[model samples]
Target: MQSQILPSRAALVDRIALQFEYGQNLIVLLGTSGLGKSYLLETFITDKYNDFNKAFVQVGAQMTDVQLMTQLLEQSFNAPLIDHNLSLSQNYYQLAKQQQCGACLWVIDGGRHLSEELIAELELLSKSAPNVLYIMIASQSKLPFKEVVNIHLEPLNLVESKQLMGWYFT
Candidate 1:
């Protein structure tokens, strides 16, 4: 498969990998749309495929907190359905704690759409499972917590942009 090698993107991926290697749990990627955030994340995931059991959740503006949480629980753990909020979160935390996957990575794209409550639930997950990593792909929206390491992605430079366009057209 072919890939676009942009310096900013490569650097962002390196920074994220280094942080995870050093035991950081929450890493946020912030950039405007079309900044290659998803592509960078895909590259990172592919490179770390052997080290983590990764789950990618694409957040949409229409999804509610319950829906988002349910999607995550189903995708990552497949735990039984539970109605109560606390029970649902606890179940997810328990499964994360028991994860045998060398490390578990939860990558949420379009994370700006996630409600504050859902974000809090993610924070709870980080607290419960130190072996798990949360990579949130946000556009302009700031993370609520101060603890998260926010990596801002810059748009492609003239040369990189021309190369990308040339590759796309040719």
Candidate 2:
């Protein structure tokens, strides 16, 4: 189960591991559908920390900007209704700031479904939070954040794919 077919990618994985260990604030994983981006992120997060404060948000096809922001805020804060008065965007930014202060790893999946406003807010948070790690999984690169280490995930090579299949199918 523990094998990798893309022997050339060993260096890439090592680089990513080093960045994570050195406290890089943002890591962007980009690839097409069915590339196992989510699986890789999940495996890395789970392997990294037992009690990691990880938040997962899957953007729906019909999700609006407000809805996306609210979902992100809710998941990050663990609060069902966070401030009824503030707008969804406002609440989301606030929650992101708070999470960054707490040094939590925020994983945003399906970010391509988010609206422009949500993306802007995420860019702002990425800039402001030095300690907060934001891992974004998207079909392509569209992040407005600067200095984001982008990893273009391809299908695992033969050896790695076989290992993954065996691990899951067994």
All candidates' lDDT scores? 0.68, 0.62
Provide the TM-score for each candidate, comma-separated. Answer: 0.83, 0.69
Clashes of each: 0, 1
Clashing pairs in 1: none
The candidate scoring highest on TM-score is 1
Kindly list the per-residue Cα lDDT of model 2 for residues 1-170, writing each as its tens digit: 22442454455556676776775656777888887666556655565444456667667778776666566665556655567467554665566656543445567677677676666666666666444545555545556655677778776778877776886697
lDDT of 1 by residue, 1-170 (tens): 32566676677677787887686777788888888877776775566645556677778888777776666666665454545556445767566556543466777788888777777767766666545555445546777865677888787889889877987797
In candidate 2, position 39 carries an lDDT of 58
Worst 10 residues of 2 by lDDT: 1-10
Which segments of model 2 are wrong by more than 4 Å? 1-14, 21-23, 50-52, 78-89, 92-101, 130-133, 140-146, 168-170
Query: Candidate 1: where is the Cα deviation over 4 Å?
Result: 78-84, 96-102
Q: Candidate 1: minimum summed lDDT over ten consecutive residues — where?
A: 79-88
